[model samples]
Target: MDPGLLYDLSMNDYLNFLCVSGYNQTLLKAFSGAHYRCPDIINIMDFNYPTMTIPKLYGSVSLTRRVKNVGSPGTYRASLRVSAGLSISVKPNVLKFDKIGEEKSYKLTVEVTSPGDDEAFGGITWSDGKHYVRSPIVVGGVRGVFHVLDKTQFIDLGKLHQQLNLEVRRKRRSKALSQIAFVGVLCQGGTVDCMK
Candidate 1:
């Protein structure tokens, strides 16, 4: 089976394939348990990538804000917070709308301290003490620390089967041997290799 299929296959599909391929019930159960133990792959779906385009590190972008209120005037403050490996500065962080239909523009500058495959995500929040609004700030061309694993490696059934079998055998042997070795001794009563 193609390695790509491992990533694309749902849990049910994977289990069904295993069953159809003549894998015993015990092996199927073991595979299911191992699959559940593996950490979930992080993907772009895990984070909010706003549609708005942000500049690369050490670059600047202009953002416009317009306030329209037919009833009363309010003061709003703007602030920015970025993820690690990035810094942000907003030239006029605070905005005051003295009247209705007031609009303003600010220059936002970003600096990247570390270059790597990690995503930089943050938000620009505007608040008037009574109400608040936020816009997503995203820095592209970078990946986050938690990222999708390489599906190619994940889909290798032969390697996966070998690992599962080894683990199952180790577990089965350890339980029976521990009782016969020593009650409370290091190396699990010599069942485990402590010197090597």
Candidate 2:
């Protein structure tokens, strides 16, 4: 979706953005005095924009995503930023590749331990210092531990927060409709809302 979603364009069952940047820093380094021929491309795996719902808290919730490097092999760093009322983390904070097109799995876990009753928001940013790619995340306020059968659907993890209480309140269950998922600008720098 790097150049597809308009945030304005509606694709098949998914939102679109005019442009997106999963931090592919090729042009940004081209002007350097030294010869820069390597391409550092960081891609978010199976990322669905707008936002994703955990469905149920049940004490803890976890998700996995795959990120692959299609450019020159190098090391890319992964960082997480989340909201309150939950505890989120990712495995292997530092990613390295010996060859191109290599992929890695990121296991993100979330645990709700606060009684704040406020929604949680955050994301995981993969950066090579120049290009910063962030997948935004927002977790709605929950009320209690729940178990709903047959309501199965999930997406990738972005941001995170909190990690203390096991007595999490269940969130509201509404069947209105899923949110319109859309990607923002494929920015290739620091954390900020951007589109181009």
Candidate 3:
């Protein structure tokens, strides 16, 4: 807090001190100077879906791209790419931007082949023959058999047996049979019924 200490502090040090002192508003205003402004060449959407469960075959999502600065005012191109284990096709994979602030959207179709639950990740890259940037893309899907287990740990079966009724036990057995039938259908490609 000494007055002489301020003279030795650099611009970054001053901003860091302001930020650590909880003067976030004042820190942002100080950093938003004209000299801090720079041209943004390209901007793309970031995929942040924590978990997306999709069925087999096809799942689609729309991706958006925008040209923040069209330097020479010519054609700029962008393309989409996906990770392995997933077949992806982008409608209008190649995008053209004529001017700055021009935005375009593309449809991304993903074909899930494997039956196991998995996640896919990739990115889209845009370039103007001089500068380029890649934005991340993520997709998650579940195929084949899926299971949902109950929290039976809290219910002590030994203690429940004394108070359990036939109806309650039958209902639990019926639920288990239905799950088994679903798994059989997915794995063997045939309908199964434990009740029958």
Candidate 4:
């Protein structure tokens, strides 16, 4: 490492650095608690369970979130929203804080009506009707009723598969020939179970 390449920052300057790049996984660990960047706002502390996975989702699940309003004299409304195949209910959703560091525990009841669902999305939000503070959520179960994951930027397997199928159709193969050969090849490759 070159000495000249490294620059040191004061505590205040380091905090500002965190404000800009705190979401980065590496920086979040290096700086410890990046949650202090905005002190005059509601803080969702110990948000360790942002994403959860269940092998087989059946019936419903109960979750609790402890929240504290670090800002002085603040009042906000908390709510829970979920996608289809699931629902969530929050207890004592409204919050009123006259003093700083007013802590409250919110009970969340998550119901998964359909066990066969592959995935669903939801979130918890605290809003003052001016600014919306949100926490994202993702839940997953078994894969594939379909051939692909929702296409992503880094790897467009789904789109590529569609394109190749289009090309094959243009080639004019007979009904006896294989259709969507890529899917068959992928299944044979053993990464995904074709039997499922």
**Between candidates 2 and 3, the lDDT winner:** 2
Write down the lDDT of every candidate, Cα atoms only. 0.50, 0.48, 0.42, 0.52
Q: Which candidate would rank higher by lDDT, 1 or 3?
A: 1
Strongest candidate by lDDT: 4
By TM-score, who's the top model here?
A: 2
lDDT of 3 at 35: 32
1 or 4, greater by TM-score? 4
Instruction: Work out the TM-score per prediction.
Output: 0.41, 0.46, 0.40, 0.44
Ordered from best to worst lDDT, the candidate numbers read 4, 1, 2, 3
lDDT for 186 (candidate 1): 28
Query: Which ranges of candidate 4 are over 4 A from the true structure?
Result: 1-56, 142-196
Cα lDDT tens digits, model 4, 1-196, are: 2111111233544444455544554565466644444333322322324333333334555555555555545666877777777777777787676765566666666666554436777887876665465656566742222233322421455457567667767887764342443321233323444333
Whole-model lDDT, model 1: 0.50
For residues 5-79, could you state the per-residue lDDT of candidate 1 as single tens digits?
Answer: 001224754565455556776787787875332223332222222223543333333443333433246766877
Regions of candidate 3 where Cα sits further than 4 Å from its true position? 1-70, 142-196
The alpha-carbon root-mean-square deviation between model 3 and the true structure, to one decimal in Å, is 16.5
Model 2, 1-196: lDDT tens digits are 2311111212311211111342123532333433333323322223433244653354665665656665566676878786767777878777776775566666677777673456777788876664455666666654445332221111111111111111122243342222322122113342233221
Q: Give residue 161's lDDT in candidate 4 (0 to 100).
A: 59
- Of 3 and 4, the candidate ahead on lDDT is 4
Measured with C-alpha atoms, the lDDT of residue 34 in candidate 4 is 42
